[model samples]
Target: MKKIALLLFPFILFTFSTFAQSANEDWISLFDGESFDGWEAAENPETFSIEDGKIAVHGPRAHLFYMGAAENHDFDDFVFKADVMTTPGSNSGIFFHTQYQEEGWPAHGYEAQVNNSFDADPRRTASLYNVDDNTEVIFPDDEWFTMTIQVEGQHITIMVNDEVITDYTEPEDVDRGTNVLSSGTFALQGHDPDSKVYFKNIKVKPL
Candidate 1:
């Protein structure tokens, strides 16, 4: 019996290692930390900058789109997450299912509103914009939190620090083009000059 168990142990270890490797392959890192190597910024490139390994969003209105080398910078069913920190009165957002625009607010996709204490927008963090707004503030200002957005087909889920905040399913009669709920890339919003937000460890796992 002991000899048989020893023989099976090696096979079990190999199988477990192989499964772990496959799971890791399903995930991809979107940000390289030092610079915006695979990202594209709108109008003012200065609005998006890397500070101490975090993607700092400040300055005037602008959007940073992910134009990465894989999948043509587009994703359909995937789980995206980032570590975010907001200063007092800061406002920002994480936009998905959106296309790239030269200037102005992203006409395409849905924005997961990121605001803690900003006076302009009453909607706090984890609200799925107008689609499914959650007025309950789940994040704290001047602290780091994990913001996660997961999309599977017509369903969307937004979470803050592992807490589910918004779960929305797209309606059949939704609008088409640039504000539409369709397959597109991801983006980060720079609300205004007064707002300052930090994001790091941006990653995605295709479902």
Candidate 2:
């Protein structure tokens, strides 16, 4: 019996390793810390910068988007995540299923609110902007926290620090005005001149 068990051990270990590798491959990074090689900014490109291996936002309105050639910057059902840190009174957002424009707030896609202590906005991090707003303060500003967005079909889930903040299901007949839920790329918001936010480890797994 001992000899038989030893013979199967290698197969079991190899199976586990293979599963781990497959899982790791599902998540593809969209940002390179040193530069914006895979990303581009809207009008005011100067609002974005690289500091301490992170994308820093601290200027007038602008949006940094993933235009990488890897995925063609197009996505529909997917899981997106990033490590975010906001200074006091800062406001920002994570826009998914969105396209790029020369300027102005993205008229398409969904926005995950990233305001922690900004006095102007009550909807805190992981809130799906106006769709499903979240007001409870789960995390503080100036601290690194993980914000995740998962979209499967018409359902959407938003999480912060692994805590679910919003779970929404779009109705078939819902009206989105000019903003429509369709396949697109990802973007990071530089809300205003007063708001300062940082993002790192931006990655996505298309479903």
TM-score of each prediction: 0.94, 0.96
> 116 in model 1: Cα distance from truth in Å?
1.4
Report the lDDT tens digits of candidate 2 across residue range 1-207: 999999999999999999999999999988878989988899899999999899999999999988998679999899998999999999999998898899999998899999989878889888899889998888888899999999999999999889898999988898987565778988899999999999999899989
Which pairs clash (backbone N, Cα, C closer than 3 Å) in model 2? Answer: none
On residues 1-207, what C-alpha lDDT tens digit does candidate 1 reach at each position? 999999999999999999999998887999999989989999888999899999999999999999997678888999999999999999999999898999988888899999989967778899988778878777788899999999998899999988899998888787655676678899999999999999999999977
TM-score of 2: 0.96
Model 2 misplaced stretches (Cα beyond 4 Å): none
Per-model CA lDDT versus the true structure: 0.90, 0.91
Backbone clash pairs for candidate 1 read: 108-178
lDDT of 1 at 40: 95
Instruction: Indicate the worst ten consecutive residues by lDDT in candidate 1.
Output: 173-182
